[model samples]
Structures are given as structure tokens and as C-alpha cells.
Target chain A: QVRNELALANAQELINKINEKCFSKCITKPGNKLDSSEQTCVAKCMDRYMEAWNIVSRAYISRVQRESQGESL
Target chain B: KELGKFLESENARMRLQQSIHTFTDLCWDKCINKISNKIDRGEETCLTNCVERFLDTSLFIVKRLEETRKKL
Candidate 1:
């Protein structure tokens, strides 16, 4: 239970960092406090960042697998 | 040797992830030019290629440095 909670906290911290980055990228100006369009942009940016993260993760994994195979051969 | 091996593996893992984060930041700037509802195919491809090329660049530099060290 403690481990799970700690993991959750770490995950939340990462999410917060992601949110901060994506929000800054998507929202250029502090227009009248987050209009509907800005909110939508934030949502989409978050999704896109997650997708990029996954893509990068998979690409790195595959590259490692290839290199290890080459090393063994 | 065992302690060194453990530290080396941990260092490698951290470096790999750090390079990915750096690549993501660079490619995000290049590929993600606009704010959109979905990540288009172009952007996806760009991100993947960016990581691959970045790794290649790092490896190439490391190999060159090792060769230089051998000569010295």
C-alpha cells in the first residue's frame, strides 16, 4: 500500500510537470483567465504530449533492442 | 566490478531517458508548430525520426572519441 501510494504521488508529480509545460506551450497569453478555446487547447496539447512521450519511448526501446541484438551476434 | 556494473547500468538508463526528453523537446518545437485537436501523421513521423537521428548522432560522436583516444 505504501509503495502504491508513493508511485501514485510520483505519477502525479510527473503529470503536473507535463501540464505546466504543455499549458505554457499552448497558452501564449493569459487571456481573461482560460477561455473555452484555451481550455480546449490545453486538453489537446496534453493528449499530444502524451502521444509524443509514447512514441519516443517506443522508439528508444526498439533502438535498444536492435543494438543488443547486434552486440550478441 | 559488480558495483561498477550496477552504477554503469543505472547511468545508461538515466542517460537514455534524458536524451529522449531532450529529443522530445527539440522535435516538439519543430514538429508541433500549431495547436491542434490531434497529432497528425506528419508530426508522429517527425518525432520518431527525431529520436532515431539523435541517437545516431550521439553514437557517432562516441565512436569518434574512442578512436581518438586509441590513437593517443
Candidate 2:
């Protein structure tokens, strides 16, 4: 219930961040269409962003566990 | 209660979101230079290492701060 809503909100935030970051990086010119090159750039940027997200999540989780272990010791 | 669990999960989600934003900024600065539409092996490795080292730096700062606080 509440958790689902929170997850949705977080996802929305990420989407907004992606739009801001990738749009700036990929779309130098707003052509009639997204243009093939621009579309490809956006696609790749999204993929790389996801990869970065996972890497950060893993690093953060392990650091947290280590810190908690130290607290108990 | 169910409400307590929901709140716990919500906190976790928020934390995850915050970290994602921070890392996106950090790694985006390092790994992404232009719209190449393809991440090379070197950039991918840099992104991974950027995240790991950022966390390490954060932990190191916290530990240093704690020590400083103890001295004060």
C-alpha cells in the first residue's frame, strides 16, 4: 500500500532526473523528429544510467552492512 | 503492525532514490563525456569504480568526523 506508493514516487523522480540529464546530453538540437542519432544517444544514455544506478546501489548496501557490523563490535 | 512495515520500506525506498541521484551526478561527470550512444569498456569500468570509491570516501569522512567529534 504505502510502500508501493513510495516506490512509484521514487521511480517518478528517477524518470524526471533521466529526462533532465539525458535530454541535455543527447538532444543538442530539437529537430522535427528526435532524429536517429538523437534517439540512439538517448537509448544508450538510459542504459548507462541504469548500470550506474545498480553499481551505486551495490556499493551503498555493502558499506551500510559494514558500518552496522562495526557498531555491534 | 502493517503500517510500521510500510514506513520502513518507504524509508528504504527514499534512501535508494537519494543515492541514485548522487551517483548519477558523480558517475555522469566521470563516465559520460558526450552522446556517443554507446558506453565503452573503459567508461563502464570508470562508472563502477566511481561508485565504489565514492562510497569509500563517504565512509572515510564519517569515520574521521566521528573521531573529531570524540576529540571535541
Candidate 3:
């Protein structure tokens, strides 16, 4: 139960970030309604943002591994 | 007993995930310029390097603070 909540919270944070970044990139101006092109742009932006997040995670994890190894040796 | 171990690991994972969220928020702003069909190779490299450098900066600050404390 507690584990599930933690996972949910983590996912929620990711969703909030996606909303913030995708909105800023895709919506140049506030409009009454979201048009199709804006929707498309948001989709692409979200995908790229996720990719960027993965890249960052990989880089950080690898650096941590390297530093820990250096310290142990 | 088992539950305690599980919770400890969960907490550790949560902390790691939290840091990733912060790094992504900051580095995305620095590396991403325009929304395109795909993330280019240059942008990808920039994002990776951004994370590495941010951690380096963090370590540098801590080390500097410790040295200053020792001197004082």
C-alpha cells in the first residue's frame, strides 16, 4: 500500500513536469481552445522530454557508479 | 522484518527518483530550445552533459564548504 502510493506520486510528478514543459513549448499563445496542431506539438514535446529524462538518469547513475568505484579503490 | 527491508529499499528508490526529476526539470530548460519532430543528437549530448556537470558543481560546492570550515 505505501509502496503503491510512492509509485503513484513519482508518476504524478512526471506528469506535472510534462504538462509544464509541453505547454510552454507547444502553446505559443493562449487560446480559447487547443487546436490539432497544438495537440500534435504537445505530443512530440512530451516524447522528447521523456527521452531527455532517460538520458539524464543514465548519465547521473553512471557517474555515481564511477565515483563510488574510485572511492572504494 | 521483511516489510522493514522492503520499505527501506522503497525509500531509497524514491529519493533517487526525486533527484532525477529535479535534474530533468533543470536540464530540459538548458538543453531544449525548439520543439521538433525528434530530439537531435546534439541536444541529447547536451542533456547528458548537463546532468554530469550539475553533479560536479554540487560536489564542488560541498568540498569547498568543507575546506572553508576546516580553515575557520
Candidate 4:
């Protein structure tokens, strides 16, 4: 129950970051609708952003484990 | 370590929370050139190395600062 709420909050925060970053990177000019290119860019950007998050998560987790083990930084 | 047990430590939880934001922002700039459907191999490698060296630099600085402070 508590863990689920924490996960929800984390997901919300990630969504906010994706919107802010992708908006600037994808939406240069306002159009009547999201043009094909902009839509594609946003879709790709979302995936890449999540990938970036995962990469960091894995690296940091391992580093933390190493630190806890008294391994030299 | 168990995720639930790890979260029980406030210090560990908070440090992780802070580090994730720092690492994500730092690595995003270093690794991401333009958003693409998939992260290329080169970019993926850069992100991992970026995190490792970043922590290395941070530890180095802290050690340097402590030594200098002891001299004062």
C-alpha cells in the first residue's frame, strides 16, 4: 500500500520531466496539430528519457552496493 | 540487499533519492545528443561511465577537502 503510493509519486515526477524536456526538444513551433515529425520526436524522446533514467538507476545502485561493501570509490 | 529493508534506513533512502536526480540530469546531458527511439551503444556506454567517474570525482574532492582542512 505505502510502496504503491511511493511508486505512483515517482511515476508522476518522471512524467513531468518527460513533458518539460520533450516539449522544448520537440515543439519548436505551434501547429494546428502535432505534426508527424513532432509526434515521432516526442515518442522517441519519451523512450530515450526513460532509458536515461534506467541507466542512471542501475549505475547508482551498483555504486551504492560497492560503497556499502567498503569498496574504494 | 532487500528493497524493503533498504528503504527502512532513512539515510539510504534519502541519499538514493538525491543521487538519482543528480545522476539523471548530469548523464542526460552527457549521453543524450538528440532523443531517439533507442539509445545507441555509444551513448549507453557514456551514461554508465559518466556516473562512475562522477562519483569518483566527488569522492576525490571530499578527500582533498578533508586533508586541507586538517592542515588549517
Candidate 5:
């Protein structure tokens, strides 16, 4: 239970960082409020970000696998 | 409060998601040319390639630097 709680806390910290970075990228200028178009952009940006993350994670994992295989040979 | 612990856990998940989100945005900008509602086949490939190549590049650079140091 303590371990799970610790993991959750760590994950939350990561989210805050991502939000700051993504928001800056998606929102060029801060308007009075988030307009519909801006909101749409943010939504799309979030999805794209997730896709990119998966791709990178997969790539990294595969590269690690390949390196390990090479070492075994 | 119990809610405090729940909030903390939720925050952690958000953080992990956000890290991935940033990485995707950075790589997508570098590798993707066209932006649409869904990632097309070509763009998807580009993204994967980009990630692999980026990692390779980092590793290569590090190795090269180490070799240079050894030669010194």
C-alpha cells in the first residue's frame, strides 16, 4: 500500500511537468479564456503527445532488447 | 484525509502521462510533417523511426565521446 502510494505521488509530479510543457506548446498566447479553437488544439495536442510517448517508449525498449541480444551472442 | 492520498495518487498518474505527452510532442514535431485528426500510416512510421534514431544518436554520441577520452 505504501509502495503504491509512493508510485502515485511520483506519477502526479510527472503529470504536472507534462501539463506545463504541453500547454506552452499548444497555447502560444494566453487569451482571456480558453476559446473553443484553443480547447480543440489542446485536446488534439494531448492525444498526439500520448501517441508520441508510446512510440518513444517502444523504440527505447526494443533498442534495449537488441543490445542485450547482441551482448549474449 | 483519505481523499488526500487519493489525490496524490491521481496526481502521480497525471505526471507520468504528462512526461509521455511532452516526449510525443517533441518527437512528433521533429518527425511528423502532416497533422490531422488521426496519425496516418506514414506519420506513425516516422514517429517510431524518430524515436529509435534519437536514442541511437544519443548512444552513439556518448560512445564516441568515451572513445575520444580513452585516446587522450
Candidate 6:
């Protein structure tokens, strides 16, 4: 029960971040409808953002492991 | 016993995810100027370095603060 809620919150946060970041990157001019080019840009931006997130997560984890080992020694 | 381990792991996962969100927000602006079909090697490297240097800056500040405290 509790776990599900936590997972939902995490996903919700990611969605919000993606929307805010991609919107600015894609939608230079707000229109009544999103043109094809803007839509394509949004998709690419979202993919790149996810890639950036993974790269950051890996770097952070490795740094943390190294710091912990240094502290113990 | 099992429940305690599960909760502990979940707590760590949550913290890890939160940090990723923050780094993505900061690094997106720094590394990404134009949207492209793929993240090129340069941009990927920039994202990784951004994370490392940010952590380094954090540790540096803390150590500097401790030294100042000792002097005072």
C-alpha cells in the first residue's frame, strides 16, 4: 500500500519535470495546436532528458560509493 | 527483519531518485542548448561531469566550513 504511493509520487515528479523542461525547449511560440515540428522537438527533448537523468544517476552513485570507501579507510 | 530491510532499501531508492531529478533540472540547461535526434557524446560527457563537479563543490564547501569553524 505504502510502496505503491511512493512509486506513484516518484513517477508524478518525473512527468512534471519532463513537461516543464520539454515545454520550454519545444514550444517557442504557443499556438492553438502543436505543429508537427514542435511535437517532434518535444519527443526528442523528452528522450534526451531521460538519457541525461540516467547518466547523472550513475555518476552520483559511483561518487557516493567512492566517498564512503575513502571515509572508511 | 525482512520488512526492515525492504523499508531501508526503499528509502535509499527514493533518495537516489530525488537526486537524479535535481541533477537533470540543473544539467539540462547547462549541457543542452539545442534539441537533437540523439544526445551526442559531448553532451553526455557534459552531463556526467556536471554531476561529479556539483558533488565535489558540495563537499568542498562543507570541508571549508568545518575549517573555518575550527579557526574561530
Best by DockQ: 3
Regions of model 3 farther than 4 Å from truth: none
Model 6 per-residue lDDT tens digits across residues B1-72: 999999999898888889989998999899999888888999999999999999889989999999999999
**What would the per-residue lDDT of candidate 3 be over residues A1-73, giving only the tens digit for each residue?**
9888998998999999999989888898989999999999989999988998899899988998999999999
Instruction: Please give, as one word, the docking class of candidate 3.
Output: high
Proportion of true contacts reproduced by candidate 6: 0.80
Better of 5 and 6 by DockQ: 6
- In model 4, where do residues sit more than 4 Å from their true spots? A71-73, B1-11
The TM-score of predicted model 1 comes to 0.76
Worst 10 residues of 4 chain A by lDDT: A1-10
Encode model 4's per-residue lDDT on A1-73: one tens digit a residue: 5556666667777888888888888999978999999989999998898888998889989988889889653
Per-residue lDDT of A1-73 in model 6, one digit per residue for the tens? 7689789988899889999999988898899999999889888988988888888888888988998999999
Tell how far residue B38 is off in model 1, in angstroms: 1.9
lDDT of 6 at A65: 93
Expressed as tens digits, the lDDT of each residue in A1-73 for candidate 2 is: 7667777887887788778888998887788889887888888888777766776677667767887899999
lDDT, candidate 3, residue A10?
89
DockQ of candidate 4 is 0.61
Cα RMSD to the true fold for all candidates? 4.0, 2.7, 1.3, 3.6, 7.1, 1.6
**lDDT value, candidate 5, whole model:** 0.69
State the weakest 10-residue window (summed lDDT) of model 2 chain B: B34-43
Best-matching candidate per TM-score? 3
Once model 6 is optimally superposed onto the true structure by TM-score, how far is the C-alpha of residue B39 displaced, in angstroms? 0.8
lDDT of 3 at B37: 77
Each prediction's DockQ against the real complex: 0.46, 0.51, 0.81, 0.61, 0.31, 0.78
